[model samples]
Target chain A: MSESAIITPPLSDDDIMKLKIGDRVLITGKILTGRDSAHKRLFDLIKEGKSLPVDVKGQIIYYVGPAPAKPGYVIGSAGPTTSYRMDPYAPLLMEHGLKGMIGKGVRSQPVRDAMKQFKAVYLAATGGAGALIAKNIKSARIVAYEDLGPEAIRELEVENFPVIVANDAYGGDLYQEGIKQYRR
Target chain B: MRRDISHEKIKDTVARLCIDANYFLGNDMIQAFKSYIENEESDTGRDILKQLLRNAEIAEKEQVPLCQDCGFAVVFLEIGTGVCFEGNIIEAINDGVRKGYTEGYLRKSILSDPVKGKNTNDNTPAIIHTTFVPGDKIKITVAPKGGGSENMSEVKMMKPADGIEGVKDFVVDRVLRSSSNPCPPTVVGVGIGGTFEYVAFLAKKALLRNIGERNTDPFYADIERELLQRINNLGIGPMGLGGRTTSLDVFIETHPRHIASFPVAVNINCHVARHKTAII
Candidate 1:
C-alpha cells in the first residue's frame, strides 16, 4: 500500500532512522554475498584479531548461494538463503560496521538486538524466488573464498533489487507485526 | 510374465526428472499460488505470491532452477515384482543425479562426508526409497528438497495416552515456533505412527502428494483439514513476513504403530515444492 523507498548502502544513521519495518525498498549499487561457510571463516578471522580479506564497513552482505550461470548470463538463479545459520557471525559483523543484511527467515534475538544497537537493519527478498531475483543482478565477481564454491564471497552489482524492511534500526520487526495484525 | 529393465533406462529417466523437477514446478502448486493470492489479506503477501509464480515461469522459460538450493535428490522408486533390473539400481540412480546436476547447471549440494567432508562436486547418491509393487513397470519420482524447509522438520515420540490433542498440539506448535524459518506458505507433511525413523520417512513421503490433496483415510483427512486451518490462523503469510496464507496445505500419513510407540514427524516443504514423476 506504500511506495517503495529507494536506498543505497553505506547507510548513515539518518538514513537508518528513516526506514521502518514493512517498508518496501529498492536497493541499487554494489552489495556483498556470503552464507554459512564464508561467515564462519570471517567470524574466525575477527576472533583472531586478523585483517579480513575484504572490508566490512558500510557493506551489506546477502545470505545467498547461487546456482552456476550458463553461458551469456551475468549470474544464475540467486535468492536469499535462510538467515538463521549465520546468526553467530552477524553481531560481530555489525560491530565491524556491516550496515545491513539481506536474507530470508527469522534472525535470533541477539541479531535483532545488535540491529538496534548497531543501526543495522535486516531486509528480506521473496524466498524461493531464485530466477526472478537474479534478473536484478547486473554483474558478479568473487571477492574472496573462491574454494567455498557457491558459499564464496562475491561482490554483486545490482539495480532496483526488491526487498522488504523486516527489521529496522528503531527495533521494529515486520514478521512479528504482520503476525500480530492477522493472528486470529 | 517378467519384464526386463536396464539400468540405462533408469539412469536416463532419473537424469531427466532431476532437471525437469528443478526447472519446472508442478502445475498444482501454481494453482495453489493463484488461489492463495486471491485470499491472502496482506499486500506484501499477495505480492510475494505473485513474484513466486513469476519466478516459476521464468525458471521454466529460462531453463534455470526454481531455487538456488536445488536440494537433496530424494528418489522414490516402486518396481513391480515381475520386473528385473539388468544392472545395479543404486549406481544407475547416482549416475543420473551426477549427470542431471552437471548438465542442468543445478547446485551440487551433496558432500562426501557430513561434518568434515569435501563437496562431492556432482550431486549423487540420491536418498532413494524403493518398494516392490504389483505391476511389471517401474515408477520413479524425484523430489528435490531444500535445506531451509527440511531443517524445520521434527520427529517426536509421544505416549499413547497423549492422544489426538497431543498430536494436534505438536503439529501446530512446530509450525508456530518455525515462524518463517521454513519459508512461509509451506506444505506441512505429517507422518504419524510407525517407528521413529519410519515416521520421518512417512512425513516426507506425505509431501509427494499434490497440494490440497487429502489423505485417503477419513480420519487423517479430517486431521489434515483441521491442521491446515489452525496453521493459517497463525498469520505467517508468504516468506514469513506475516499473512493469512501460512500453509498452502497440510497432509497426514498414518501407519500402524506398536502399542507403546506413537511416533510423529513433520517435514516442511517450501512453496517451490519441486518433484517430477516418470514411469518405465
Candidate 2:
C-alpha cells in the first residue's frame, strides 16, 4: 500500500484502467462543489455564454449539498449526494475544462464518455462521511446561486482530501469492476 | 378523558427529534456496520464499511449530521384518543421543522414540487402519518428518509399465489438493481398483505423496528431471516463495493389482505439509518 501507487499522476484512459479498486487517493488541489440545482444553473450559464462564478479549467467538482453550518463551523456534514442527479449536466462541465469529479455511486455512460474525452477523473468520498470531509475544508465562500441555499456553488480550500477513484480518465470505473468481481 | 398538550411542546419535541436523529446514527445501525466490516470478503468493501463506521462515530461526537442528505422528515404519530392538543398538530410539526433546519444546521432537502424542483425552505410540510391508539400519551417517531434510498422503495400488488417467495424475489431484485445507488449496506423494510397504500405504509413503519429484530409471528420472522440471508448472498456488500453483508437487516410487517390480492412493498434505508421517538 505504497502512497505512490495510490497517488498516480492523473493519467490517460489506458493508464487509468491499469489501477484497480481499493486504491486510496489523497487528492490535493482545487475542487468545486455543486448539486442538482447548482448544476442546472451552471449549465444554463454556460449555455448563455455567461461567465461562471469560478473558472472550472483543470479543476475537480464535488457533487454535494451540505447541511447548514453550526455556529463555529464553516460547513455542516458535507458529504457526496447521489451522482446520478448531476449526470445531465456533467459532460457539459467536462467540455469546459473540468478535469475531475468527487461524489458517490455510479456515473452514466455519457459521464464516463466525457471523462475519457476530457482526460478527467471521477473520485468518491464516502457518502455519509460529512463531518470528516468538512474537516478538509479550510475556508468557504459562496460563488453564485445564493437562492439555492445549501445547493449554491461555493469556493472551498481543501487539503489532503480523501477519495477513491470511481472513474478514471481512461474510462475505467471501479463501480462496475468491483460489482463484477464480487457478484455471486 | 383527553389530557391537553400545548403546541409549544409539540414544536420543541419535533425539532429536537429531527436534530437528534440526523446527527446520530443509532446503535443498531452501528452494530450492523461492524458486522458488515467483519464479514465483507472484498478488501475494498471492508474498507468502505470501516469508513462508514468511522463516519458515524465522527458525526456523533461532533454533533454534525451523518450524511449531507439530511432527508425529508417522515413523522409517525400514535396519539392516544385520550389526549387532545390546543393547536394544529401539523402546523406545529412544520414550525419545529423550520427551527430544526435553521438552528440545528440540518439540510433543507424537501422540495415543493418533485418535478418542478422548487425547494420548500426549512424542510416544511412533513409527510406525517397519525393513528389513534388507546393510550393516554402521544408517541412521536421521526425518521428522516433520504432521497437515494427513498427512490428505491417500491410497492407491488401480486397475485395471492406469489406469497412469500414472490415477495423475497421482488425485494432481492430491487436491492440488486440498486447496487451502490442507495448507499448500501441498507436495511430493507417489507410490508406484506395489506392493500396497496397500506402495504407501503406498513413497509415504512417496519423500518422503525430495531435492526435484527424479528417479527412477532414465527412465519414472518422466518421469512425475514431468509430474505436477510438471501440479500447478503447477492454480494452487493457495503456501498456495493463487495462484501458478505449487503444488508444490515431486513424487517417485515404483515396484515390480512383480500383473498384475491397480495400486496408487498419494500423500503430501503441507507447505512446511516436515523430514527428517534418521543412521548408527550
Candidate 3:
C-alpha cells in the first residue's frame, strides 16, 4: 500500500467513496456508539418520525458496547461487537446520511450496496483490543437510552483511533479478498 | 451421599474467579497469542496480535477486565453424587455470580428476558448447567463468554452418514463463515454424538480443554490436529486481518448415540478464552 493511500483526508461521502481496500485510516472528531439495542431504538425513532437522539447525517456510527468506567476514566474497555447484528438497521441509517461504519465482521449486501450509493466506508477495529481502543476515546457521554446498559448510545471524541478499511466505498471487501488470497 | 457445600464458599469462589479470569488471560491463551505474533506473515495481523498482547498486559496490571464485554457469567457445575449441598445449589451459584460480578467491577450483561428487555444489573441469575457425575468432589468451571463470539456460535444436526468427515467440514465452514466476527485465531470446540442437546453440551465442554492439548484418544487427537490445520489454512488470520493461524486449536468431545443419529455442535471461543476451574 502506498503512503499516499494511507493518508485519507477528513472524509466526506465523496472522499470515503474513493477509498480502496487495505487503506489505513486515522479517524478524528465525533463518532456515535451503538450496539444491538441502540440500533433498534434508532430505527424505531426513524419509523415514528421522531427525531433521533443523535443526528446521523454525514456521520460515522461505531458498533460498540463499552464496559463501565473506573474512576477518572472516560470509558472502560470499548471494543466493537459483532457487526452483523446491526446489519438489519444499517442501510436505513445510511439512507439518512450515515457516511461510515466502524466495527468488525462482514456486513449484509444491502448495507454494502448502501455504502456504494451513499459513498460510505466500513472500518474494522481490532476485535479483542477493547482496552486499547478505549484508550483512544478522549471523552464519552451517554446521549440517549441510558437504561440499555452498555448498549446505550454515547457520543465520543477519538484521536488517532486505529482502524482498517474493511469495506471501501467502491464495494471492495477486505474479508472476501483476504480469504480468497489464502484459501487453498 | 451429597456433601453439603456452603453458599458463602461458592459465592466467594465465583467472585474471585470472575475477576482473575477477566484480568488475566490464561496461560494457554497467552501462549497462543505469542505464537501467532511470531509466526503471522501479514504485517497487519502481527500488529493486531501485538495490540492484543499489550491489552492483556494492561488489563492484568491495572486489574481491569480484558474485553469491554465482560460477558454473561456461565457456570458449568459437575455435582458429585456422593456429595450433598447444604443449601440450594442453583441459589448458591446465583448468589456467587451476583457477588462476583459486583465486586469484580465487571459489566452487568445479563437481561431478565431476551424479548422484554430488562437489565439484571448484577449479571445474574447465571446460566448454570449442572450434571451428576460419578465423583466425590464438586467441580465448577466459569467461562465469561463475550457477546461477539457467542453471537457467531451455531449447532447443526447431520445425517449419520456425514460421519467424522462431515463433522470436520461443518466445523471449518462455521469458522470460515464467522470470519472476523468471532475474532480469529480462535478456539473451536466440536461436540459429536449424543442427542441434539447433548451434542451442544459436549461442544461447550470441549472448550474447557486447554489450548494445544490433544484428546487422549489417538484417533480423535489426529482428527483434532487435522481440523486445526484446515481451519488455519482458511487464513482468517489473527483478528481476520489475513495471514495464517485463524484458529489456535480445535478440541472435540464425543459420546455414543443411537445407531441412526449423528449430531454435531460447534462452539466458537474468541482469543480471550476467559475461564477458570475449581474443585471442592
Candidate 4:
C-alpha cells in the first residue's frame, strides 16, 4: 500500500475523514507522548478544572513511555505501548478536543464511539519495533510529570513517523477488519 | 567438596546477563524470523517481519534495547546441592538486577506497589525461581518478559472429557484473542496436566525452550506442530495487520494431573524471546 503523509497538531476534520482503515501514514510535526500514569494525571487535572500541563486541544497523543536516552541520542527506543489501557480516559480527552491517538492494540467501544462523535482517529505504530521507531522522532523534552520517569508527558517533534490508520472517525477499525479478512 | 559462591559474583553475572539479553535478540529468534519471511504469504506480514529483523540489527549495532519496555528481569536459578553460597541469593539477584538495569541504560519498569504506583527506580527485586539439583554447579537463566505479551497468558481448568481437542481449542483461542497485542508472530507456550499453579509455571518454563526445540514426547510434540499450524492459519498475521505467519512456534510441557482436574495454561512470548543462560 502507498503511504500517506500527514502533519499533526492541527489535525482537521477533513484530514481525519479522508483516512481509511489500513491506510499507512507517515505523520510529521509535534505530538504529545503519554501512557497510563500520565493519562490518569491528565484525567485528574481535567476533572479538577485545573489547566493541563500542555495544551492538548487538537493534539495527537502517542501512547508511549520511552527508555532513558543514552548520551548521544535525542530519545531512546520509543514505540507505541498498548492502547486498551488508555480506553477509560480517551473519551474524556476527545471531548476536550484531542484529535488523534497513536498506539498499538484494539480500543474499547466507548473510545471508538468517541472517535466517531468527535471526529478523531487512532493510528498504530508497530509494537516491538521501538529502535526503528525512535529513528523517526527528531527531538523530545518532558513537558510534565517528570517524576513518572518514562511515563512523563513529553512534547516530541517527529519526522515522517510511520503509523497505520487503526480506527477512523467514521467507525472503521483495522484490527477487526484485518482479522476478519485473515482469520480462517 | 562444597564450593562457595559470593554474592558479588552472582550480582555481576546477573547484571551482565540482563544487559546482554535485553540488547541482543536471540539467534534462534532471528532464524525463526528469516524462515517466516520466506513462508509468509502476505506482503504486509513479510514486510513487518523484515522491519523486525532491521530493528534487531539496529538495536545490536547501536547497543540500544530491542524494545523500550526492557521488561521485568526474571531469573531462574538451579542451585546444586553440593554448592554453597556465601551471601543471600535473593539479595544477590536483586542487586544484580539493580546494577544491570541502571548500568545497561535499560528501562526501570517495576513498581514497588501495584496500587500505589511508584517506581522501584533500579528495577530491583527480580522474580527469582530457584530449584535444587544434584550437580556441583549453579546454572542461571535470565528471561526478560514484557508485560504486553505476558498480559495475554491464561490458565484454565478443563474437564477431562475436553481432552486433546479441548486443549487445542483453548490454546488457539488464547492466541487468537491475543491477536497483535502480544506482538505476533509469537512463541506460544502451553502447559498441560500438573496442578493449577504448577501448570502456570510449566507454561512459563515452556517459553524458555528454543523455538526449534520440541517436547520429548511424540504426542505432545505433534500437538505443538499442530497448534503452530492452526495459529498461523488464523491469518492474524504479523502485528495483527493480517497475514500467514501469526505464530513462529508452539511449545508444550505436560505433567501428571489430579484425577478430577485438567489444568491448562498458555504463555505467549513475543518474537524477541530474549533468554540467555550461564553456569557457575
- The most accurate candidate by lDDT is 1
- Runs of candidate 3 exceeding 4 Å displacement: A1-11, B1-4, B133-136
From the highest DockQ down, the ranking of the candidates is 1, 4, 3, 2
User: What is the Å distance of residue B81 in model 2 from its true position?
Assistant: 0.8
Candidate 3 residues B142-199, lDDT tens each? 9988878887778798998897889889999999888888888789989989998899
Q: Give the Cα error of residue B197 in candidate 1, in Å.
A: 0.6
Flag clash pairs in model 2.
A13-A170
Candidate 4 wrongly placed segments (more than 4 Å): none
Poorest 10 consecutive residues of model 2 chain A by lDDT? A1-10
Clashing pairs in 3: B1-B82, B2-B83, B2-B84, B3-B83, B3-B84, B15-B100
Of 1 and 4, the candidate ranking higher by DockQ: 1
Task: Note the Cα lDDT for every prediction shown.
Answer: 0.92, 0.83, 0.84, 0.90
Q: First chain TM-score in every candidate?
A: 0.97, 0.87, 0.93, 0.97
lDDT over C-alpha atoms for residue B96 of model 3: 82
Tell me the tens digit of each residue's lDDT in model 1 across A30-103.
Answer: 99999999999999999999999988888899999999998899888999999999999999999999989999
Task: Specify the highest-TM-score model's number.
Answer: 1
Q: Can you write out model 3's per-residue Cα lDDT over A20-79, one digit (the tens) per residue?
A: 777877777788889888999899989898988788887888898887888878988888
In Å, residue B201's CA in model 2 sits off its true spot by 1.1
Q: Which docking category, incorrect, acceptable, medium or high, applies to candidate 2? A: medium
lDDT by residue for model 4 over B189-231, one digit each (tens)? 8999989899998998999999879999999899999999999
